[model samples]
Target chain A: MSGGGTASPRHVITGIGAVAPTGLTCADYWSAVLRGESGIRTLTRFDPSGYSATVAGEIPEYTASRYVPGRLLPQTDRMTRLALIAAEEALADAGADPSAMPPFACGAVTAASAGGFEFGQKELEALWSKGGKYVSAYQSFAWFYPVNTGQISIRHGLRGPGAAVVAEQAGGLDAIAKARRHIRSGTPLMVTGGVDGSLSPWSWLCLIRSGRMSASPDPEAAFLPFDRRAQGAVVGEGGALLVMEDAERARERGASHRYGEVAGYAATFDPRPGSGRPPGLRRAITMALADAGMAPADVDVVFADAYGVPALDAAEAEALAGVFGPRGVPVTAPKTMTGRLLAGSAPLDVATALLSIRDGVLPPTVHVASPAHEHLLDLVRDAPREQRVSSALVVSRGQGGFNSALVVRAAA
Target chain B: MAPFPTFTTKQLVDLLRECAGEDEAVDLDGDILDLAFTDLGYDSLALFNTVSRIERDYAVELPEDVVGEAGTPRQLLDLVNAGIAERV
Candidate 1:
């Protein structure tokens, strides 16, 4: 449980940067979440009316030029630009200067489930309308899944061990788990999480192919997780990035605050259909608590993956029911405010969990008035639950059955 | 057919400025014709996009390695003008 055969350094999240649909910064996003404001509305990026699902959780009033250098604008995708902005905000919030740190002491690990779909769609259009040569050379790396890690590393000069996870929605927690590995393996800092977008028309076409996106035109009715009206997820863009620093290093560097500690993490995969084995979420939850040297009762709140599909929602409810029993724990899904953000959503939930631990309030699952799983879940709806939150468990299940659980607790 | 408009040094400089965007730290308008693109803050990727822009804008295709071959604005201009001449 230690790094380099020494005592395991406590890996704590010192800073957070978020670019969710509801808000642009960590403070703004938290405020919007607490207010129960929904960012889901009609898609203005294009005529999404032509598509089955018209509403989306696009980041409001975002201009990449304001955050990124002009030189990087033409080369990077909207996804990477969003990540760069978040990383900058995170480093600034953590007050850790990578340039001032030792060589190779910092790293970055990000997740990307939909690798620059907007950028790829643009290039594909050029190829179709004109020719292959018209495609931007930047497309080579921009559309690739790991470019977020590469861009963040390059931007922040994080030359330490770096990686990118692509396990769909589960990828965020998986990415954070990877960051913990580096922190435990002696790396001092990691800028980790997932920010993803594939919101263009071409990618929209591909998204519906999964049969998981909600086709409802009404924004309020589009995503009703744990409700009978639950149709499917409204795909969203934007996520969060957090600065995870070793405890001693954060203290030595005079970091202003510790958001929380990454107490434990575990990931599992659902058994394929027709297999006798059960879904892995319950096991993941149990194993993560054990890793944190805590029990299920110790968790204060549960941030669900909240796949709005009825069967998936029921399965998640069943998982929570199995772990904490029906109505044993308070559960919420603020993503109802900002649809599901693919790989980015889980990390957003994790960030929200840390904020919950910091502020001692549980953000609500908005828009789901009637709880279909009231017998199975103490779903925190409509109002912020003002309770002391010390530790939280974030549960996420990616497309193709990737399941992950992460435990974040207040610093001891 | 008349050769595509001559790819002049001024034109290349204008394109480079447009490609990389006019940044305050590095002046794309200075005496940058002989200086390496990297020295001018235009990395390989920037050069790639500039080259791609040149191709699409002028409708004259240069060799794929034109970017690799042209390290400076002058070199890029030479390659682009040659491609323009070949379009005659």
Candidate 2:
């Protein structure tokens, strides 16, 4: 696959920040992942007694006041607050100050699925009961999906190519891909990732209506992806963002704490099963490999989407088999411990993939003692598997036929 | 008519401090007269809310243009004084 265009500059992951279900920081989250600890527990944001799924991956004991000032709290929702904190951490980790850099040279792109649903719900309650005048003026901006990108840009003074991706669960990967494009096209740096908290009754109800949520009340079994008992995924809340920069620029700045390089990425749509077309995940994986100038054998580990639905699981397994041949690759879905964070899911997976490359260890998929897929792929379970991970293939499938694949390679 | 209610510099500073929240970096002894609300660690929205509270408490309507033009505590105080004099 050749094209008549300037070769894009290599994009490297210089920093990582996360507010995940297991922990608030990337180190804590990675520690929990290595221990195979599950973040899924009984829902405390709201009463789930009457709901189908009573458990979810809720952030334990999160206090936004610790990160956001009181003056700005009313104007920010949980989603934006999480994004702001994660972006700050990522920038600090990269030793890059947006204020010190040319404002237009720095940019941001984020993914949001249910834009501030908790805040919007409050405004709607006020409108329905206390009348329109009682609704908050902040609602006008805080409840929008693009508000995450807007707030991050304003807070950091990043005037460069700012945007948001709303591709459902695949939006995280899409946002990273867009960030890579922006960097290659002249933007010096970008803060890109995804964060969402939809555990509120209104948000959870919306998720339940989609028929994808697991009805199990057991926390451990609620989101058993790729397991025979996999009913469906439990909705989780959290997000992770990364600071991506040009490889040469980072090295020139003497930045030593590098995670990995975003080698390649590709996206496709599944278009339902019976459109007389093949599954899109396999094509997306193949294209991503080609984009990275790599082969199937070059990939050391596969980060499965692990939707926790029977049909979707089978389809994903088949796609993996088609790419790497029968049981040709080691696969894992660490999201089993974090539930499915919707838009935040893929970004967190990307973060974990980078960490896997750094540590040369494949994080375990929690609570999968028996492999469910008949294809017999090597699934990492029980404990972290030690391996020389040079490249990782992270794949995600969204609700509305969105399939995305990203290849992250160990730092050069 | 009842004597127009007047605020001392200290009272005004206290009000600003209260409106800005305890966590804000509002300096009571610093150049409050020249410092912008943002410099005092209050965003534009917070300043608006503070202005609204001042109007309700003082029974005077601040001019609409004051929201954008009043960058300093001195400008805000002048606007309130003008409103008081006009009512008188």
Candidate 3:
């Protein structure tokens, strides 16, 4: 794909960081991504005893004391710990300090569907095993609501404005969308992204009850989004953080910008279970393009929200055909490598899309041997493809009827 | 896709030691929650982490609700024994 023209209202990504199965930092994650390394492994975090789902994408050998200092390690859950680590990396990468910058100018936001389930499960297990007497007091705060955003804010000393968006899978992209709005409205620097760590026994049980988990035991065979034999999506755990700043602020700071801007963001709701494909998400894509002042033809690549479910895959394909026409857009789903990070999924895609725009390379969607649907969308597989991308459209949807689209542009 | 025998108490102690990552002497007859967890310095996070390791090693799902009824070490042993029975 070649660039048609330049995109406008560029929101610069000055900092990118994450604590993921690929790696502990954005540099490590990006390198692993380029090499196409798989992080999925057997369930080692807990005994799956009677549970059917056996595999997961888990962060290997993560210790909070290594990333976060000794003092704050005990107070935060693993999910928050990952978020803080990523945020710290991003802040350091951006070379911005809230104290050095204007007061009330730096704020933070995070996307999260659930926080600290591993911690919650442990406490609950204690409660059940010991009749509440052994339930640790720390569970109250460790399992506190929106703990990721709170921990990130406290860790970074970011006090401008903080919020946690809850849209299940779309939370990450929506958080970035909100951060872009924050940067546009008033705040100079807004840190945004999402995190999830729900692989604990209780959490895993809950997800199993939700009936969305892929039952395939083999990691490679599991989570084949947009593939014919795709069962259901697998669960992965991690967090990614981005330091988004106003284009003007970014330029003034002399920060090396990766992408042009978060030009537009639009979300739609698709209520009613088992409804045919996501027309709501398709409308969201069109709306986001309109918000970015671009057309479907202007979008060079598409980071697809391939949910790995047959119904969802079909819906998204139809929606893409309707929006971008039968010619189709280049679509890639990298989450197939890490399973779905739930809330963290969309932000990772957003980051991937931004990186793609910056480097003029399309990351491949692995494990997809064939296009699951008849739709004409170009699903890049196996290897990276060269593309002169000016604008990229990233679409994401959550199971609970939430859909969102974000437009990212190449940095001039 | 693998199976292992139901763990004996000695095997469980060894597993617990390996899972817990420390040499805190466990009271096998005492409260599993308090002794194996709190009093033994294993916090909730650590306990869950240990449980996750156990589940992976055993390839079993210790039902959250099933474990809730156990408090004493004997009770936990019985719970694990029953889970292993059901799976086998």
Single out the weakest 10-residue window by summed lDDT for candidate 1 chain A: A1-10
lDDT of 2 by residue, A374-399 (tens): 46577888799998898999999889
> Across residues A215-319, which tens digit of lDDT does each residue of candidate 3 receive?
988888878888998888888888688888877778887886555678778999985767655358778888888887787888898888888888888888888
Candidate 2's DockQ: 0.24
What overall lDDT, based on C-alpha atoms, would model 3 receive against the true structure? Answer: 0.76
Superposed by TM-score, candidate 1 places the C-alpha of residue A125 at a distance from the truth, in angstroms, of 1.3
**lDDT rank order:** 1, 2, 3
How does residue B82 of candidate 2 score in lDDT? 83
Locate the minimum summed-lDDT window of 10 residues in model 3 chain A. Answer: A1-10
Give residue A219's error in model 1 in angstroms: 0.7
Per-residue accuracy of model 1 over B1-88 as CA lDDT, tens digit each: 7545888777776776676554557876578889888887777778887888888889888897887899888888888888888887
Off by over 4 Å in 3: A1-10, A131-133, A273-278, B1-88
Q: Candidate 1, residues A264-333: lDDT per residue as tens digits?
A: 8888888888898888988888888877888789999999989999999998999999989889899999
Clashes of 2: 0
> In terms of TM-score, which candidate is strongest?
1
- Each model's lDDT comes to 0.88, 0.84, 0.76
After best superposition, candidate 3 residue B72: deviation in angstroms? 36
